[model samples]
Target: MGPRFQNNDRARLYREIYEQHGPIAPVVLPGDVPCWLVLGYRELHQITSDPVLFSRDSQLWNRWPEIPADWPLLPMVGKQPSILYTVGERHQRRAALISDALAAVDPFELRSHSERFADRLIDELCGRGSGDLISEYAKVLPALVLAQLYGFSDEAGARLVPSINALVDGGPDALAGRDTVKSAMSTLLASRRAAPAAGVASRLLYHDYARDFSFEEILEDMMVNIVAGHQPTADWIGNSLRLMLTDDRFAASLSGGRHSVAEAMNEVLWEDTPTQNIAGRWTTRDTQLAGRHIAAGDLLMLSFAAANGDPQVRPDRGSFTGGNSAFLSFGHGEHRCPYPAQDIAEGIARTGIEVLLDRLPDVDLAVSPQALVWRPSPFLRGLASLPVRFTPTPKSTAGGSR
Candidate 1:
């Protein structure tokens, strides 16, 4: 997959891929890396469900010797001690530790943090009346809240936003961004070790299973959690808001309807999920999937966007997917996004959108929907900028505002 895969109408591209090569098609990555792109819903489900056959271990990859040190995709598919590549029983324990740490985050506090950060971000642009929501609000809000949850102070949390964004964007600064994040996480871990705090970092550092994991392992897990949590949540907010503003179906939302907010968010998950494709599962043994022959150790990319739009499952793609939580946007099976993490993401994203609409009731797209641009990254789907205009309202006071 190249930049065009993300930059162009990706839905149409998925359709073309499906028609040409069926559900599982051969494709090349940025470094001319060959892999199977699993586009069928059933095919993807089968692969994710049976992790034993399609392992998560990057070491299982057969092309590692040919992969150069500086390969751009290395950061993604590179063999690391992180949970993303972990397999078997050890992976299950790691997943549980992460889930428990995240699950401890109070839902009430989570929503409060979301609203507080949402308000702070909107406060910066409410008076301007015209601002890019992606930069001014959606992009920064989730990181700010998540950083605090992970034990960063307000200033440090604010500082983490740019680095997180750059890292997720996978641009020239991605490596540097990764380094900065690692350093910040290390410092946080050290600080938490010295003085226990009420946050996910402290929980992870002192969990019953903490002693079972090494410092580097725990640190890698934290980095994975933070990076994975921030960007996709941010994109969820951006993409959902874009849908509400552009789609006539959600026009009622702009005028103070709360019900449509959830609807639009769910719809985005099915149609324009932030995470379009994942680097993916490696075949443990040669097997036939969707009638395609795959050799042992072959790489298979999961196309969630295509799977959610699979013609066999969603024959009427245009119909409203009301309360249909069957979408594979979050993956399936053991390695899927943990339920607790999904709850946190939904809380952050939903609250962000709700607060923005409540604050700027008349907010409308500043540019034509057709003119809006998407970030040029194959892994994530989100707006480069969501420029919107609303009637200028007086800034809110710390106590209360009109």
Candidate 2:
């Protein structure tokens, strides 16, 4: 029997699945379709790295072509070549170039931008005394960061963030959000192509992969970076902050010098990563992995959340390190996330948390931790709204400027 992934009680659900399913186990998802969920840290590591046996090209997925129009799984599994769907040479070439483009980003500049944006946002909220951190701060801040990376105007971030959020929700909103993203990306990239800017998107358009990528291809890549980076970054920010507030030991670890902010971020990435599962890895042929039987064209998913929490993984950050380390929150091999490295992303989040803690000395959850609601989704783990109460303070003279 397969495990039902309960939205509200994810920790318990993941533990039960691991205890029962071993590392690689069979399960039927919400759509009544069967799939193998890779649960163990070592098991997922092997599968995610083995490209010959497990293909990412969704065209190999048997049920996708005729999936019901109303299927909830579409948002997570739908074909998008920008990063998640490509396999083999395509995946390798595209990922390398995107990585190179992101490598050019100045970490100091990114951190400064995040801090300035945080201060500006807090300036607007300090007088109010309370606000929904998820909507007001966490979500918008990441999108704005992404907007800067893509060289998008301030106006574009406002439009893209909500549309991207809606896009991930699936169904009718997904369609609208998809169009909104496509329109925004197309306009943004088209301008870059016409008169290139000194940024990630413009650099990508001139990279090696762009030789084979059409205008549509370039746009898809742009959309994936902005969409991928923002949501998970937002989730990371929210989840990490939640840990600081709810887990007294964790909070103590951060405040009492047991763990630095960087170490705390690593702990969150291992313990409660924003991305719970990455779907749509199809088996190339009948095979057995980690002593499990599989058939050709069988669907598989990597349970990063489950694996990081596996008994095998050490929870301690060990000297506050980051990088490709043992944590699979960023996935591994050919299909990893194509954005800034762990250190850069963490730098942005660090600045954000630092600003919030500095500006609002006593900010805290507005409700009990257990009462917090996680949105129902197959791929993402996010709080629906993070209502936070803070001491009222005078707004900065900076006003509401970006």
- Find the candidate with the highest lDDT and give its number: 1
lDDT of 2 by residue, 198-292 (tens): 77889889987778777877788777777777788888888777877786645653333334455667767876788888885898899988788
- Candidate 2: residue pairs that collide: none
Instruction: Evaluate model 1: give its lDDT.
Output: 0.89
- What's the TM-score of every candidate structure? 0.97, 0.90
Query: For residues 245-275, what per-residue lDDT tens digits would candidate 1 score against the true structure?
Result: 9889999989989898899999999999999
What range of 10 consecutive residues in model 2 has the weakest lDDT sum? 315-324
lDDT of each: 0.89, 0.76
User: lDDT value for candidate 2?
Assistant: 0.76
Q: Candidate 2: which stretches are off by over 4 Å? A: 1-8, 64-66, 250-259, 312-325, 339-341, 397-402
- Shift of residue 150 alpha carbon in model 1, Å: 1.0
TM-score for model 1? 0.97
Which stretches of model 1 miss by more than 4 angstroms?
A: 1-4, 398-402
